[model samples]
Target: AILNSCEYGEGWATDTYEKALKDDAEYLTTEQQAMIKAQHALLKADHDKVKSMHDTLAEIA
Candidate 1:
């Protein structure tokens, strides 16, 4: 609750960064939205690869 209620002072993480950090955002900063989407895609790909490897190892075991 403290983080959510924090005031936006500057672009610094210790300030407004908490509020800037949101979820399921369709438009984040407008400029960084595309980059954020790309980052999410990379995360999903990495997660899928890890999951697949785990499943394969489980089957082997």
Candidate 2:
């Protein structure tokens, strides 16, 4: 749900800004960019931890 919210927020931001410009360029505010970056970092950390656990389990099994 948290990831979904981030995705939805990104989509909304793109629609609200890019649609006005009619271009593929991003126009995120500083705060929006920071928020997205933080979310991505969290997701990456979670993924890395899960992968490490899976690898450890596989080694034991």
Candidate 3:
């Protein structure tokens, strides 16, 4: 259940960021851009961690 929530949150954040980048980049303040980039980086890190966990579980099984 927690994993599902994380996946949903990540998907929503990714979609929102992509839309902002595609549709509003030119209008965004520098600080806003930096914040979005930081969010993206954190999301990517979470994804990588999940993938690593899956790989380790696969190896164990």
Rank candidates by TM-score, best first. Answer: 3, 2, 1
Best by TM-score: 3
Please report, as a residue range, the 10-residue window in candidate 1 with the lowest summed lDDT: 2-11
RMSD vs true structure, all candidates:
12.6, 8.3, 2.5
Task: List TM-scores for all candidates, in order.
Answer: 0.54, 0.55, 0.63
- Model 2 per-residue lDDT at 25: 27
Please report the TM-score between candidate 2 and the true structure: 0.55
| Native-referenced Cα lDDT, model 3 | 0.77
lDDT tens readout by residue for model 2, 20-46: 344422676667666666665565566
State each model's CA lDDT, in order: 0.47, 0.56, 0.77
- Expressed as tens digits, the lDDT of each residue in 1-61 for candidate 3 is 4555666677677778878877999999999999988888788778667656666766897
